[model samples]
Target: MSHSPVHPQLRLYFENPVGRLLEHPDGYLVVQYNAGKRKLEELKTFLTQASTLLQQRNWHKLLGDQRVMAAFTEAERVWITENWLTRSTTAHPYYGAVLLAHDVFARLAMNLVMNEARESGLVYRLFEDENAAVAWLLQVP
Candidate 1:
């Protein structure tokens, strides 16, 4: 995924979307959408990756970089709170640091995720850069 993602038409290609789920050498997962908007399937795929990693490694920290990601639909947000959060991992993430895009729509989308997730007992903080995100992850809550 590119550090920044932008497009005029926002066309999506299903066979090879710009989304990526990668593990950082620092021992955390970093999920990114390098281009176009994220549909429900893409979002679920990423969440599945996180769940699988957590099941194996049991880490409760992850960096969700949505700088290149697009805004999410309301139903998508609800899906996360309902299904993903409930069945994600044995050691569900309590502290999440997110890197958001400069776009207001994307920022608001993330805000909704973080806020509504509180109802499910997940707390995530937004960050403009990776350094601050990792720093917050290291700090004890």
Candidate 2:
């Protein structure tokens, strides 16, 4: 894994199971997952780390870029919905962006997940471009 300090407070890490955590200026956290397929255990570990970051930072915004996640197992899907999505709803992150670039399957799944998240009182937006995602996140005061 290679990490580069994008900003004084923001660090970007890159790896085969690529993921980057951005400590946003407004106390929100952005996690961009570019990891390919992985086992349930791996997914759990990833989500656990993300959960910890969110809790520690008291993040009110989440940006998940699943552009490279080709597919997810049933368990992985369940974990996301039960843990990350559900928790984000209760946490009431100012805004959550799920970015999907190429994977149609993941995009579809995220759409459903976003809908469920909205029902839970969390605001979510789906986008295919990074610029748009960031713009939306920044606009939400």
Candidate 3:
């Protein structure tokens, strides 16, 4: 996504080659992935940072804007599921509102990961718009 002006209510947390991680005033993490492929190391770093932030704040909601993100490689997917998601879910049954990627391959990759997340007890929903995703996240108690 373009690094357009950030919403006044959002706090820019971290911006890496992979994405921009923001903190919403209402208490959640907002990760807007850039429109490009990500190296495995970069992806791992970004997720580790996000998880750290989540644990520090005890936040349970995340808005993942993956509309322009490229597809994840098999290795990346495995690391995410085995390393990041498991750690995050064990800490809290977090709620995630994901805006699906425009690329069909990216969407498919995300779906596979999300399905695993569901089985792990995460409550999540997919959306095609940011407003709807944010609204759904806010409504989640």
Runs of candidate 1 with Cα error greater than 4 angstroms are 4-18, 88-93
Q: Please list the C-alpha lDDT of all candidates, in the order they appear.
A: 0.68, 0.67, 0.87
Any residue pairs clashing in model 1, and if so which?
Answer: none
Please write out the lDDT profile of model 1 over residues 46-140, one tens digit for every residue.
67766777567666777777776777778787888788777743444466788887778978877877777776666678888878997888783
Give the CA lDDT, 0 to 100, for residue 45 in model 2.
Answer: 72
User: What would you estimate as the lDDT of candidate 2?
Assistant: 0.67
Using all chains and alpha carbons, the TM-scores for the candidates as numbered come to: 0.78, 0.77, 0.94
Question: Best candidate, lDDT-wise?
Answer: 3
Error of 1 at 29 (Å): 1.2
Model 3's C-alpha root-mean-square deviation from the true structure amounts to 1.5
State the weakest 10-residue window (summed lDDT) of model 1.
Answer: 6-15
RMSD of each: 6.3, 3.4, 1.5
Candidate 3 lDDT score relative to the true structure: 0.87
In model 2, the Cα lDDT at residue 39 comes to 65
> Per-residue CA lDDT of candidate 3, range 19-137, in tens?
98999989999988998878899889999989888888889999998888899889999998898878865645889999898899999999999888887768879998788988999
lDDT score of residue 25 within candidate 1 = 52
lDDT of 2 by residue, 10-54 (tens): 654322254666667765666766546676776677667777777
Q: Which stretches of candidate 2 lie over 4 Å from their true place?
A: 1-9, 12-18
